[model samples]
Target chain A: MFDWLFRYANPARFMGLSGALLPWLWSAALLTLATALYLGFSAPPDYQQGRTVLILFIHVPAAIMATNVYACMVVASLFSLINRHILADVAARTAAPLGAIFTLLALITGSLWGKPMWGTWWVWDGRLTSTLVQFFLYLGYIALWNAIEDETRAARICAVLALVGAVNIPIIKFSVDWWATLHQGESIMSGNLAGPFLVPFLVMMLFYMLLFVCLWLTRIRTLILERRLRSLMGAA
Target chain B: MNFDLSPYGAFIWPAYAVSALLLGGLTLWAMARWRAVKAKLATLEKT
Candidate 1:
């Protein structure tokens, strides 16, 4: 299984595979997101939060992708460190900004939802604070990658930073349960949200995950092409 | 369909508007960057 998987570790083979898949991936992501938005908007207003609950369709998915994207980077970074795969390092490096953008969306949308529901725009609660820290970790990782001039040095250093920052992923996941917080703790999994609300949430989650995969593949392909262009220029 | 978000419409509409802007903007930007990179690679290869 591992040997078969490593066959695509070659950049050219990875490019061919990703290129063939990009159109289908983008189409599926758009389709799911559209269906999710339609369902989310049409759902009845919550007894407590009213239409503001609609924000969950976007915010919750963004939050999920935000953390998951970081996890992806950590895995990619580990592959780069262990296997010395340049493409894996490129995958990790390209994903940081996208993850940061998702994290930013989560923060902003959560704040928007919070004001109407929780009666505040920001809270220093464990979940909220840890998520905020996760956002900074993405920024720091991207900055470290950009600051280092040597590709090998940057990959090694960034992989270490990615590994270190991964400690926050579990903290972010479990924060609401670990401490009493303004953020609601584990609603979908805990059976707190009704089916009416949960279905659309799940749909949006799937859409967002698909979107991350699509975007990550696009960025990786672009980075590979970028490296090819650079080497060509150097050779010329 | 109902434009009545009542007291929270102001918050809810803008929240979605921001989400749409961010997600859509990022998607377009990434695709565009990919296209540009591919084009540059083509030109370099030709040269």
Candidate 2:
């Protein structure tokens, strides 16, 4: 079952495989994203929120990706810690910037959505504050990775941080329920989302996840090349 | 087909604008890094 993973564990082989997949992945990502954007913009506005509802398509997906990507990193961190797999570390490391960018998008877009509705650009409510903390966790993980000199040591330390930060994911998700604050509780999974809102929002969610995959693969490939270049330079 | 923003376009547009700026910027940045690294690696492998 996992045989393919082991086969591609070799850097050179992984490079060949990713090289073949990326062009197609990029094409799919771009095409699907375009479709999602069309659907999102054309979708009818929420009855109460009016056109401000358009921001929800972007904000919801970005917020979902922020948590999903961090979850992925935590899993990768665990794999790296236990098996000491080199690519696991690479996977975890390459994902941080993408995660951070998505988190920032969520923050900004959430604020944009909140202002007309909530009458403020920023708030210190539990959901928003915990998400802000999630954003900082991403930055801290990236900084920790760069701060250490030894790659192994950095991976070990950063993996621990990533795991510790995993606690915040649930906190972010449930903050609304826990605090009854500004953020409304999760609606997408609760069957409260209207039918018209569901489809485009799901497509946008797909688009965001696809974007993450494309960039993550490219970054992994880049790291492999960088490692090979360093080895070649050293040998010369 | 005509699409109406139904007001609140101010908040709606900038949300997308920032998303595009950040996401697009990162995509281009990653591709550029890939190109530069590929070229440098190719040059080194050649010599």
Candidate 3:
């Protein structure tokens, strides 16, 4: 059933396949992002939040992608731990910086939004704090990977760290409910956000996810090429 | 395009700007690394 995925798991095969797919992915991501950004101007303002609701367009998507990208990294780390192949390690390693950027984007955008509405740049609210922790987790994972010289050993240890950090994902998600937090409850799926706000917001979310995939794939391909170059140099 | 994000333009603009800068910078870095490595690998294999 998953043979297609497994078939391309080999670095050579993955290069052949992803090379064919990446142009399309990049184009689609850019086109949709342009559409979403344009539509954003038309997204209706909140009666309570006013045009400040505009912040929600970028903030919510970056926040969601921050957690989602980390989750993807965890899955890649699992594959890295279980399999002998280096492709999984390449994936998990390549994704760390991207995830860190997304997490950073989320935190900064959230801070920008918080100041006007919450009257403060930040608070020790559960969700905000956990998300901050998530950013540090991403940074730590990257630093740990770079600190170690041995690839295989670094892969295994970092995989374990990613697995341990997986516990924080749910905490970030449900922190609003579990603790009285200034971060509002999830409104995207609960039919709470108005239609005008919802459409552009959802499109922006799609744009962010697509952008993440395109960049992630590019980074993975770069790592694979770097590995190939290393082996060629060693052989020479 | 909507410059009328007034009353809250200060906050809204910065949020968008930050996201744009970070995401854009990452995209450029990824593309550059991929291109550089791909060229180097090609040169290596040609030899």
lDDT of 3 at B10: 89
Give the best candidate by DockQ.
3
lDDT of 2 by residue, A98-182 (tens): 9999999999998988888777887666656777878998999999999998887888889999998897667655864466444
Write one digit per residue (lDDT tens) for candidate 3, span A1-236.
65677899988899888889989988888888888888888766777777876787888888788888888989999988887568889899988888888888878888887888878888666657778888888999999999999998999999999998897667655764466434555432111346678888888899998898888888888888887788889989
Query: What are the per-residue Cα lDDT tens digits for candidate 1 across A136-229?
Result: 8998998999999999789989999999888756765576446644455543211134768899888889998998899889988888888888
Give lDDT per model, in order.
Answer: 0.83, 0.83, 0.82
In lDDT terms, how accurate is model 2? 0.83
What pairs collide in candidate 3?
none
lDDT of 1: 0.83
TM-score of chain A of each: 0.90, 0.89, 0.90
lDDT for A162 in candidate 3 is 95
B-chain TM-score, every candidate? 0.79, 0.88, 0.87
